[model samples]
Target: MQWIAALPMYNIAPALADDWRALLGAVLGRISPWLDARGDTVRIVDPGADLTAFWLRDDVLLSQTCGYPLLHALSGRVQLVATPAFDAPGCERGGYRSVLVAGAQAGASSLEACRGLRAVYNDEDSNSGMNLFRHAVAPLTSGGRFFSSATKSGGHLASLRAIAVERSADVAAIDCVTLAFVRAHRPELAAGIREIGVTASAPALPFIASKRVPKGLVDALAAALSDVIAQDEALAGRLRLRGVLRFTEADYACIDRYEREAIELGYPRLA
Candidate 1:
């Protein structure tokens, strides 16, 4: 009955990570009572922990995972808890979109203008970074290639920096929530970065528990998340969480469809 929790997606800037982690801890703490015996000893997974591995661990009581992985990689291994509604741009009804950003110096006025340039992504498994990016450019590309070169930056913020600061890449797809957080907290990171385009929307990442957990405990986790804002609106605001909403497996099927469409269109990869 090992239990671990993590929220890696929204905690981008290091200055806010500790406070954000504490807030997450408190929200989970508030739900302790409802979890019955299962909540007695929940540990926060280290922020630096490898989330990809954490997604596969049997001890994962709660974690936030991208919609792409939830369907393709961790499909039968995890159970959905709830989807957090964000009070940020590009977020609606528990779904979010990605922004295509290019360096101001690059002088690319539009996504169409940035073709055949070096591009970076958080990871191939990322929905906002890769999947949605591919879908957005699929119809606009030729010969199944979009960029002259494609590289992996490993994280959203890093992808932003790669284009905005390092100038190593001409453009990259970034999660809207991550970009909003940076623009609000540290505008300098967004310096030289301009949003040239936006990707199609998809369900926000989901809160999940390993399938090893009992159904009763999973239900309790969902109940707690749904009532978190009501339990403590102030803390919820600090965390940028508007509310949690119910989501079904069917709600995430669109992610797989994005992949299929990309293949069918003959632009199966983002460069």
Candidate 2:
């Protein structure tokens, strides 16, 4: 079977999709020759909204996934390729945080003051969008409830739009990387979204693969990813790319800790 390479997370925004594709194409350019030498072929693909089907297929030569699913849903189904380091604010090394945003009502206010308001999130399985946000509000919940309601906006951009444009939700949590991208490419779109606070940090989404990719090629892929950013300064700047870092799955145990801590605090859900 032919293999696939996709960076689904940051690639979702239409404003930034071409930039992601450029970087993906550059990385693939460096690595595809190696694949051809080994009698293998790979192509770049857009996995669309729901990634469950894409991730389940063993042909996932390369992909990115959130820490929540890396621990909860994916479990042992996929293995790490490498972690991409970002040069955005609220990012350090290869870890990133989520920024809690709101409109005029909650502007520059404390989380406690924003109680009983509606909240939007990218997805329940999203570490930055939901897991970290849950941990941030867990201590403020009463009787296992915090927001008057919590709804899924499907993606980080949608969450921001709900809070800023439609005004259907009072607040939402978005990953630092996506926030940085929006601020750079769609600054006006983010003018109304105020950053009230930020959630804790964990490994930014990680590159992953199934058994379809060989160990040698995985190592080469990681090295190529790390080197490409340095060799192509323009791509690096556009992608806000720093470099790639090697991480064992153990490094992501903190995700489980955040979830456990929230549960212990009586906030079992992001409601």
Candidate 3:
């Protein structure tokens, strides 16, 4: 069967789409020899495809996924390979946090000040967009909810527009790396949004392979991922990719903890 790969978490906007494509090409280039030796072929898929269906495909050779779905819906179906380290704020040691953002004119000084405002998020399954936002708001809820209403904006950039440009919502949680990318590539949009705070940290989104890929190939991919980032300074700087960290399923337990903590606090959903 043919194998597919994508790095779809942060490339919706036209400004940074080419950067993601460059990063994907660099990583795949590093691993091509190993794949060729195994008589394997890999193809790049559109980052704009329906993410949930794209992720679940049996022929998945590599992809990046949020920690929330990896621990919940995607558990057992995908194999963890390595975590990409990023240079953005709220990111360190291959772990990341969700950046809470409001409109540039929004005067909410802190998270608590944004009470009862409409909340926008990317997806229910997204860690940075929903899960981390819930965990942050969980302790602030009065009647099992914090926001006056919740709206699904489909993606982080869309959520940002809802807060900054469209003015339909007052708050949102975006992956810090994606926020950094926006600030660099699409400054106009970034300038309209104000970051209020960051959520608790979880392992960054990880590179994953389908269950069919063997252990040896997974290790090679991880090694190549690290080598490419460290040595390819141009690509690394462009993407803000710092380095890589190979991890097992155990390294991601804290993602499960984030959800559990939210449930314990009585905020089961991002309402």
The per-model lDDT (C-alpha) reads 0.82, 0.85, 0.85
- Which candidate leads the pack in TM-score? 2
**Model 2, 1-271: lDDT tens per residue?**
5788788888646746887777777777888778788787788887866797787679888888898888877888887889989999999989999998887655547677778888988888989989999999999988999888999988888888787778888888889998998987767659877888899999989988886678888888788888888898888888888999999789999999999999999998899
Residues 16-124, candidate 1, lDDT per residue (tens digit)?
Answer: 6765676567757766775555535678877465777888888887878999999988888789988888877899999999998998778997888888888899998
Model 3 accuracy (lDDT, Cα)? 0.85
Better of 1 and 3 by lDDT: 3
The lowest-lDDT stretch of 10 consecutive residues in candidate 1 is: 32-41
lDDT of 1 at 81: 85
Model 1, runs deviating above 4 Å: 34-40, 47-49
TM per candidate comes to 0.93, 0.95, 0.95
Assess candidate 1 and give its lDDT.
0.82
Cα lDDT tens digits, model 3, 73-113, are 78999889899989888998989999998876667867898
